[model samples]
Target: MTIRFGLLAFPGVQQLDLTAPYEVFASMDDAEVHLVWKDTSPIVSATKLALQPTTTFAECPPLDVICVPGGVGVNTLLEDADVLSFVRKQAAQARFVTSVCTGSLVLGAAGLLKGKKATTHWNALDFLENFGAVATPGRVVRDGNLFTAGGVTAGIDFGLTIVAALRGREEAEAIQLSLEYAPEPPFHSGLPEKASVEVLGRTRQRLAGSRMARQAIIARLAAARHGAE
Candidate 1:
């Protein structure tokens, strides 16, 4: 059986978030991985890497898995009706609904995260509560069919987790071995909890603009939702 995986590709997306999982899924035998977008036009990543969409929302076939990979682009997606609708429609039938980093926020925006335990980048963790989701802190968090991953590199681990769930432990392990997926960071400052106060502060400062923008968008969304109620 062919397992079809669709990963959302958008302008300003974090390339690694999409490509890391794409690598894992594409490596699987009989697995088809697609870079899906609104159109087939080329889009650039947050780091300025160019990516071409393999399929559009209208042309993409039914997928076994629909994954959203996040970055600065996700801020715009949170309020994009078309993107949210596509995700909602796909999530309804997809076997797995998944995300990386702030992509979980997009799922939340589409009303998929309410009361579900999910996780995102540590910087955006608290924002999940605004979407009525329990903000869990972890590299990978799974609640039933919804799977979410933490910042950036965590997508690799998330992909392996999903692979194990869909295929088998042995296959997942084989893929891991084939990719040599091992991590050895020279610094212990990956997480805010483990990082020195100065390092954490500097990192937060660098991310403050995007974080603040997301906060405003979430607040606006929450207010609109309450007004409708």
Candidate 2:
């Protein structure tokens, strides 16, 4: 059977977060991939890469796997009812509801990860608690049909993991080999714990604006939920 995969395409999405998994899934046998957004217009990725949507929300076919990718754009989506509605609708039937990086934040906003183990970009990991999700530290985390991954590069891992879940580990490994997916970064500072004070501080400073915005969004969402309850 052909596996239909839909990855969210939105403005300001981290290209790697979407494209890494996209490349991996596109390599799989009988995998049909779609870049879906609210419209067919072109959207700029986080790095200013121009990407066009292959399908619109109103016209998208039901997918077996639906992936939401993270970036600065996700903050805007946190309050977007249309996008959240689309996600909730797709996730209701998709065999796998997945996300990478802060994309898990979107899933949380859609109410899909409550009480589930999930992970996101390190900077936003703690924010998962606002959605009633158990924040996980794993690069890739799966809770039932919900699969979440860490920062940008982890989307590749997320893709392979999903492929393994649907196909097999051997097939996933084959695809990995085909793509030469081996990683040997020169820095041990990938994790916050290992990062030098200088590196960590610099990154924190850079992300402070977005992080603060996201925290405010989380707080607002939490307050709304509490009020509704």
Candidate 3:
């Protein structure tokens, strides 16, 4: 049986968030992976890498898995009716609804994460509560059919987890072996808890601008929702 997977490809997306999973999904036998967008036009990533969409929201076939990968672009999607609608519509039928990094925020905005245990990038983890989700911490968190990953590099682990769930541990391990998925960072400071105070401060300072922008957007969304209620 063919497993169809769709990953949202949007402007300013973090390329690794999409591609890491794409590589894993593509390596599976009888698995079809798509880069989906509102249109087939080329979109650029946050790092300025160019990506072409294989299908549009309207043109894409029913997918077994629908994944959203996050980056600076996600703040815009939080308020984008079209994008939220597309995700909501797809999540209604997809076997697995998933996201990488702050993409979980998009799923939350679409009302899929309410009361569900989910996780996103550490910087954005606290924001999940605004969507009525229990903010869980992990490289990947799975609550029933919803799968979410942490920041950028965690997508690889998330993808392999999905593969194991769908195929088997052996197949997932084989894929991991093929990809040589091993972690060996020179610095042991991937997480806030692990980083030195100086390093963490610098990192947070660099991210403060985007973090503040996201906070404003979330606040606006919350106000709009409350007004609607």
What TM-score, over all chains together, does every model reach?
A: 0.99, 0.99, 0.99
For candidate 2, report its TM-score. Answer: 0.99
Judged by whole-model lDDT over C-alpha atoms, candidate 2 comes out at: 0.96
**Which lDDT tens digits does candidate 1 get at residues 50-70?**
999999999999989999999
TM-score, model 3 to reference: 0.99
lDDT of each model, Cα atoms only?
0.95, 0.96, 0.96
lDDT of 3: 0.96
Stretches off by above 4 angstroms in model 2 are: none
What does candidate 3's lDDT look like per residue over 33-105, in tens digits? 9999999999999999999999999998989999999999998999999999999999999999999999999
Ranking by lDDT: 3, 2, 1
Clashing residue pair totals per candidate (backbone < 3 A): 0, 0, 0
Q: After superposition, how far is residue 152 of candidate 3 from its true place, in Å?
A: 0.6
Error of 1 at 39 (Å): 0.5
